[model samples]
Target: MTATRTSSLRIAVAQLNPVVGDIAGNLAKARAARKEAAGQGADLVLFTELFIAGYPPEDLILKPAFVKACEEAVDALVADTADGGPAIAIGTPLKRSSGLHNGLVVADAGERLAERFKIDLPNYGEFDEKRVFQAGPEIQGPVGVRGVRIGFPICEDIWGDLGICETLAESGAEILLVPNGSPYYRGKVDIRQQVVVRQVVESGLPILYANQLGGQDELVFDGASFALQADRSLAFQAPQFEEGLFLTVWERNGEEWRCVEAPVGAIPQAEEADYSACMLGLRDYVDKNGFRDVVLGLSGGIDSAICAALAVDALGADRVRTLMMPYRYTSKDSLRDAEDCARALGIRHDTVAIAEPVEGFTEALSRLFAGTETGVTEENLQSRARGTILMAVSNKFGSMVVTTGNKSEMSVGYATLYGDMNGGFNPIKDLYKMQVYALSRWRNAHLPKGALGPLGEVIPRNIIDKAPSAELRPDQTDQDSLPPYPVLDDILECLVEGEMGVDEIVARGHDRELVHRIEHLLYIAEYKRRQAAPGVKITRKNFGRDRRYPITNRFRDRS
Candidate 1:
């Protein structure tokens, strides 16, 4: 391949959301994006990895029919380019004589120009690509389009030590274009920038990174797509958690290709980004799963309140239904707070008393528990009753139940198994208790721009001001059984995310006994975590896909 000196080139980055297995819908999106890019005078348009089949299509590629459907979708898009529109470099899975491969196909003017397979297939930590996709045989050279030689590396190809970028550069590639389905974790944007900068510095060529934007099950792609010049300077940046077609201009200066400066969209960080990720994840899950409405028990506690707010923000107030399941242990203040929150959010609020069901269960189990004392088992009855009621409503109304257990509670097994933990999905499963409080405060301070809820404080101040409790028994609070949220969250973070030993955690100003107890709880709770509903992953190591542990393990980190 020889590098051709082209004067100018315009590339449109389609950072759009795609639904898994929705081949026809995804094809329509691709066609519309190409038409828009053509109108903007773009020379080419780049889409994220596996846009047709959606990212992490998981086991769907194994089905011959599914793979055939994806190929048909790609063919349809290729046929649409006969009108002399901008060329397309889109991601799709291809079935070849060798094996199935995660591939990128370039199409222009009713002709397929080049097909490049992903060189690296990631298999660890939320990715199982190696199980499905076969790695490309060898490093291929760049493809020339309109006098410019461009290299296409699918997601994970450039993240390894395979020297894909270096190989392309050595083959006279002028620019590197990477299509990614990179999921959003905390501070992932910085990590991506660093990765791209390293590749650019090594290849001495401008790199454009286009990432998918949407929530696919437990994964949320932030789509903070950006371009880096060879000098490590940013050329353009698309906003995170948004779906759009952004145009970037490139011009040849002397012998090098450089991206022209364009509008750089503002990107949120820290809590704002985490909140946005949760919103997008929930919204996409609800929308993509074809649920018309969602139901959650708003207990006037911080976790449930914040989840309700998120539900309304993701799916508008009209689509959310809050049920307050009050029992003998439920306080007057909680009922009032729940009502206030529902009123502020403009959602329907109803009260379903659990006393009858609780008593009914107690009566049924009285003979079996003749000698047993009424203790934790009885308290769990209240929870199970509430869970059953919520499930009944979900079944009757055809709405999904949203569980509301935070990371701290989940880490220590503080949540009941089939009781408070019974739901289809959880919006805040990855958030720690402290993070939940902070997000609630931040939400009260300012409504996110795309939030569907009202402008004022949707989560009442009293809810944030009150003590955190499950309210399963008389005067019971969360601290009655566990440590303070701040201390517990810090210790769990060290244990779960940091993977620090007991001594190391205690050295960080925590008591030795407390650290050991928390560590024990964290380890024992793996069974429960394994059974919990899937939620958005906002941190580096969430319970579900990011961190995997054996439920029957006996080894403990005594050190």
Candidate 2:
């Protein structure tokens, strides 16, 4: 990195949203961003990890044709550099003699300037790159473009203890550029910054971190891209859960690169971040998967009401549809609350009574169980009837069904299988019952940026204040089958995320017998969770990705 007094670099960071397996679409997006960057007189443009093929292509990466398509797309983009515009640096999958690898290539003016492979492959949690792609063999040196030496580190390279960033700096790299597909969980932005800060201190070089924004399956990436000066000062921040092409100017000041111009984008945090994540996840899941709209059974309960609000905020009122599947047990208060919420959000609302279906099923089975008493099975029929009605609406109109079960109920098998759990996707699957109420209140008081839903109490006050229930039976409440939500949520947090023993959980003021019961339920519910629909992950350990438990095991937290 030869330094001069008058050298300045104009870099454009593309915080984009890419659909997995859409090589042609991703390439078109890259070309468009490059064109816009050229208009801004950018010397170079940087994109997030696997930008050409989208992030975490999962088992799709194993296909030979898929890998070839990704490589072809990268080559096409590299050839586009011959247009005499800004240089391009993007991530894609590369097949080599060593094996397939997550690779980054830099191009300038019709020439492939530099190529690098990911040094570390993450295997834990939702990442299973090691199962398919080969880890990078060695740490290569930086590439020189426009007389500046820039190093590339793909996602999980700098996060691990491989020292790839430090090695690049030692090899005369002046700037560090890291592209990532980091997903959203609570407090993830802070954790990412701390990781980069440590790397910056060790490498003694400025870093420009570019992360993509989009939802793939259950995971949603928050693109709060940021940069830091060599002196450890924040250069700029891109807004979270947003897509933008931002430019930053860096000058060679004596020996080190320093940022001169950049936009500091607003960063969403905590509950707002979580709410926006669910909304974005729903929007992308519905749009990318080719769904025209979404429908969910709104029972005037907190969970269904909040899901309705999030669906409206994501896809607008015109695209969101709500249904109230009523039975004999359905209360008038619930009827009023659900209607009020739909009215406030200005969405299409409809009602479908399930009494005939419930009665028909009962009569068909009455001969086989003439002496059987009415209990949980009979109540579950109500739920199943409701589920079937919502799915029918979806099938008839091509709209996806959004299930509204929270994490607390899902933890203890509180949901009925093929009943309330039947849906194309879930919006609040990771949020606890308490957190669901909190977000409901937050949405009423504050309308998040870019939300299509109306502001000022889109969710009614009565909905937030009401006790949650399934209404499968007369005077039925969630607490009748399980503990209070506040107590259950705390116990669940300890057992699921903390992996705490029953004895330890009991010590936190919970009853010893109750802790034991909740633990057993959590383990037994693994089967139901296995079949549950995917949703946005808000906690440290969501059901499907972050935490994977065995369904046939008998090992218990007997402690």
Candidate 3:
């Protein structure tokens, strides 16, 4: 007679986006997700790591009372799960006899089923996990769930080649479930899929991976949670760059478990993902912090135009406003393009000509400077005037000002500090200049997430086609100061992100002198980046708290 398998489990992955330090609010979101999963006949609801307290609580996990409160919240959640429909596997930091362990508390019917701690602690890049929490020793046996043994690995444990999954498989574990609070940068989604598929193949057990989705300060989490079969095929995918919940069905085979077919949600492209990440981060930062709307200077350049479209998409037309601060050097095409982009987004727009203030500033500085040649100093004055006008509008109308400088500009001190950089938040500071142009074209062609403005050509095609300029001086195109965007972005990636030396960059067939100039500018601009507004990070080495190069360091390696 053939052996038969009878048991099946329905698991719901809650791709929840939680705010830092908001325990009560996070708990509320978790409970609501659990309830929804239960209503859909799910046996278990799996949430991302530290769902109770939020991911990478950093030093907050070192506070004893905060950890205790999180444990209490976990207990309360366990009690809430006793409603008899669905069990919950949730991550939280726990204070134990040994030390503080990054852990997950599993509950079924008001009783604790298992407590799994994270074994591997990542200590590089944006993570300082090894600093605060103690690593878990090792699991002796698999967690028993519904008469079937299951393995539960916390976030970083399943990332590597060796660890819990192999041990659990050797000890009769039938399935694996992993939870994560992974932050978003470019190329992270592919890395996540590779790791999950590796675990499934290694353990010969189907895997369920859940991840958090939201913006917390400098970091943004993209929710592209997925499930994989024992054969390493993708079973289902949750939505990316949003909060969602979906159920995945798993059935028992001879001794292993396998997943059934489920609909995979839409997967956005690189440009779309970057755009949505910015919009989501901006929307959350503004709305969660209690700002009702945003205001910004609408230059005809691609950066501000794309930023305006993002603002309108994130907060709707009523919540976004634009002011064009035209100086004597401002061009007619610029005026037309700014108005066209704002009008296309259905946002309130007005021109506040700064000719008087420009004249006044020039007069004031003329007496002070006396004999200094009129150069970048005078050009920056115009930018400062526009910044002042935008800030004044923000102060009067209670709207936050959104700065619109891209990463390329921010990298090379090309942006004037306290001038065009004045704002409460920046939407595209992490995006490169070429990326800004691409996203501008993409937005003109497609409707962005939660877009409330008119559909077609919100950003005029001319804006996309125009030569990029600051218009601070007569005929001052970006190319006059920096190299073309494609070349500049490549050199910047090599220097800033790759940490490539001068020779390595020169090896890429770039002009050696130009590369050196970019490097100097990047290092010199550290001071300005320190003062810029917080924006979503879409690259490996964003110029925020993530990359910390000193402004006064003199250790240039020219060899």
Candidate 4:
């Protein structure tokens, strides 16, 4: 159907967070957002993709009851539009006669205006939409809202080579309103902007990109919703790592439509964005999963110190608890640093000596290891003791344990399997060792807005400046086993994110033998990473869903 040309349109982008499988809660949020948009004199309110059912519902869409609930929720919202204050466009799963599909329902004037299914289903990286959703067969037409023709292309439809936006534009779509459930990774904002700009340039129509916010499982969507004019100019921009209902006023000048009243929100960059993404991811994961509190073992090192600070920032200091499980090799500096960090953050701190348990485990295993040397296995006992102590505290206090292994350790198997890897979540799983140190320094320098911790430095300076150590043995440092963080992180970034070959990495001023060894360690650590707890993903590739490698694979980059 062709939509009549309008002189002006005010669209509200509801970039809100929704919980997966909570249809009732999601519907309530949608209703509230619609009401707020109506109050702001918006002609239409646009929600992110799958806002009713939540983004990346994963296998939850396979359950008949869940899909029914989502449909019912959409029905309620459709019925609520009878007031005619503002039209509603929401994402949900529609069970058609053909199959189940990811769909958008456009409702206006007490009736269903149109339904558009997603044409392209992404199945790469962390997305598995094709596994559960059937792609729409053909391109859908634009929906008319207050005399404006607005195209509704779901997330992946515009990201792929489907030409959905071009087809819609050819069919008289005046403005593109794309809803996305896009997750956050480092430098994703720029990529999304470029994608929207390309679509706008191709269609010669303004595009409004709305993305979901909050964390689900390992994915965290940074809601940096924005609008782009046909001239490839960013007309409006919403803040990242926040949830809100933003409004933009558009007016047609002659034959072209432009956003007349654009509100450009501040967009964070680099480490700031990465830190906020991690904090939001951890906060949403803990809050949505109904965790009362979180506990972690602070080893007076950079990793644990920053993790403790992050937990306190994500969940208030009242909700964070720190424990120092010092062993025989634990130095006084570690104890002092841990105490200083806890005091700085104003969180509860305790000390639990692991000497008893370490000695007990050593004695118990001495008989079996009569002929073996006391080296790595013995060192792991200390970590296992600390892990057990943290779990015990968590169980006794009904708090979840937060693991504190950065991406560098996880990449090279520098962590113990059942020890440091044991936790409900890790905030820095996607960040390398150097990134961890950088974030620690950033946290100390500036207190990010919306942080629940104190304004001053929460991570002790000593923790940031001192050498990192697991304290499993006497005078041990991370560099003793693994390469320096600067070198290791560069090599890892090349191998993981850059996907560079060993020779290519060696050409970048790295030793060929060292590159090969690091490659081997990275490959061998896959099994340990597979068993590690879920963490925030701040990079283009993370260990869990972003990078998948078989444990039994024998192929190596020998070239």
- lDDT tens readout by residue for model 4, 1-559: 2356679999999999999988999999999999999999998999999999998899999999999999999998989988868899999999998689999999987889999999898989998888999998789888888788889999888887878899999998889999999999988999998888788877899999999999988889999999998898889999999899999999998878999896898899888888998899899989999999999998899998989989988999999999898877889999999999999999999888888999999899889999997799999989988888888888898899999999999999999988988999999998998898889889888887678988878888888888888888899988899888899999999999889988889889999889989999999989999999999988888987989989988878996
Would you estimate the TM-scores of all the predictions? 0.98, 0.98, 0.96, 0.98
> Between prediction 1 and prediction 3, which has the larger TM-score?
1
- Per-model clash counts, in order, read 0, 0, 0, 0
Per-residue accuracy of model 1 over 466-485 as CA lDDT, tens digit each: 88888887899899999889
In model 4, what are the clashing residue pairs, if there are any? Answer: none
Candidate 2 regions with alpha-carbon error over 4 angstroms: 1-6
| Reference-based lDDT, residue 357, model 2 | 97
lDDT against the true structure, per candidate, is 0.91, 0.91, 0.86, 0.90
Ranking by lDDT: 2, 1, 4, 3
| Range of the 10 consecutive residues with the lowest summed lDDT in candidate 1 | 1-10
How much does each candidate deviate from the true structure in C-alpha RMSD? 1.4, 1.3, 2.6, 1.2
TM-score between model 1 and native? 0.98
Q: After superposition, how far is residue 333 of candidate 2 from its true place, in Å?
A: 0.2
